[model samples]
Every structure is written in structure tokens, then in C-alpha cells.
Target: MDIKVLGPGCPKCHETERLVKEVVAELSVDASVDKITDLMKIAGYGVFGTPAVVVDGEVKSVGKIPKKEEIKTWIEG
Candidate 1:
């Protein structure tokens, strides 16, 4: 699976990335997580908010930190 954490390298963005990593590790799922800091790239995903989580090209969450259980569901689903 391919996941992208989109933000401008803010604290919330970092936290999102960390949560994604933790979920990936706990689930033992093979996935690639990329932090997207470019405005153009982030806009390309149609996400206008920071700390957005994209899983397999789909927007999963935006603007806030998501729970680990919710993240796990996104990864496994």
C-alpha cells in the first residue's frame, strides 16, 4: 500500500506521520509512507488542510490527528 501524509512539515503533520508509522508497524503491513510538503502536490490531492492522510491514492483524513484504531482500519481496509 502507498500512503502519503500531506502537510507543510508542521507539528500536526509530523504527528500524523508518526501515527502512520506506528500503525504500519503494529499491523505488520507492507506499505510506503511519504510526507508531501509541496503545496502543488498537496493541492493536487484536493486536500486544503494540513495533516491529511492519503491511503492508496484516497484521502482518509484531513485537518486533525486520527486515532490509531482509525488509521489501522485505513491500512487494513
Candidate 2:
């Protein structure tokens, strides 16, 4: 699975990244997590939010840090 966290390195963005990692680790899922800190790249995701989560190249959530369970479910699904 390809997971991408998009943001400009804000607190929420960092939290999202951390939580995503935790979720992935707990589930033992083989996934690649990428942090998209570049403005151009983040904007290309069509997200104006500070923190965004994308799974399998699809935008899952934006503008806030998602719950770990929610993230895990997303990844598992």
C-alpha cells in the first residue's frame, strides 16, 4: 500500500504521519509512507488543508489528524 501524508510540516501534519505509522505498524501492513512537504506537490493533491491523508493514491481525509483506529481501518480496508 502507498500512503502519503501531505502538509507543510505543521503539528497536525506531523501527528497524522506519526499516527499513520503507528497504525501501519500495528496492522503489520507492508506500506510505503511518504511525506509530501513541497507546496507544489501538496497543492496538486487538491488539498488546501494543513494535514491530509492519502491511501493508495486516493485522498482519505484532510485538514485534521485522524484517529488511529480510523486510519487502521482505512489501511486494512
Candidate 3:
């Protein structure tokens, strides 16, 4: 699975990244997590908000931090 966390290296972005890493480790899921800081790249995903979560190329959440349980579902899905 592929998980992309979009932000320009803000505090929330770092928190989101940390949560994702923790969740993945706890679940022992095989996935690649990337932090996207480029505006062009984030815009290409059609996300206008920071701290967005994209799972498997699908926009799952935007503008706010998502819970670990929620993210795990996206990963497992």
C-alpha cells in the first residue's frame, strides 16, 4: 500500500507523519509512506489543503489530522 501525507513541513504534518509510522509499525503492514512538501506535487493530487492523507492515490482526508484507527483502515483497505 502507498500512503502520502501532504504538507509543507508544518507541525501538524510532522505529527501526521509520526502517527502514520506508528500505526504502520503497530499493524505490521507493508506500505510506503511519503511526505510531500512540494506545492506542485500536492496540487497534482487535487488537494488544496495541507495535512492531507492519500491512500493508494485516493484522497482520504484533508486539512486535519486523522486518527490512527481511521488511517489503519485506509492502509488495510
Listing every candidate in turn, what is its Cα RMSD in Å to the true structure after a full C-alpha superposition?
0.6, 0.7, 0.8
- Candidates sorted on TM-score, descending: 1, 2, 3
**Number of colliding residue pairs in model 3:** 0
Clashing residue pairs for model 2: none
Off by over 4 Å in 3: none
**Candidate 2, 27-56: lDDT as tens digits:** 889999999999999899898686999999
| Candidate 2 weakest ten by summed lDDT | 41-50
Compared with the true structure, all predictions reach lDDT values of 0.93, 0.91, 0.91
lDDT of 2 at 29: 93
Best by TM-score: 1
C-alpha-based local distance difference test score of model 3: 0.91
Candidate 1 vs candidate 2: the TM-score winner is 1
TM-score of each: 0.96, 0.96, 0.95
Q: Model 1 off-target regions past 4 Å?
A: none
At residue 54, candidate 2 shows an lDDT of 93
- Tell me the lDDT of model 1 at 73: 89
Cα distance off (Å), candidate 2, residue 67? 0.5
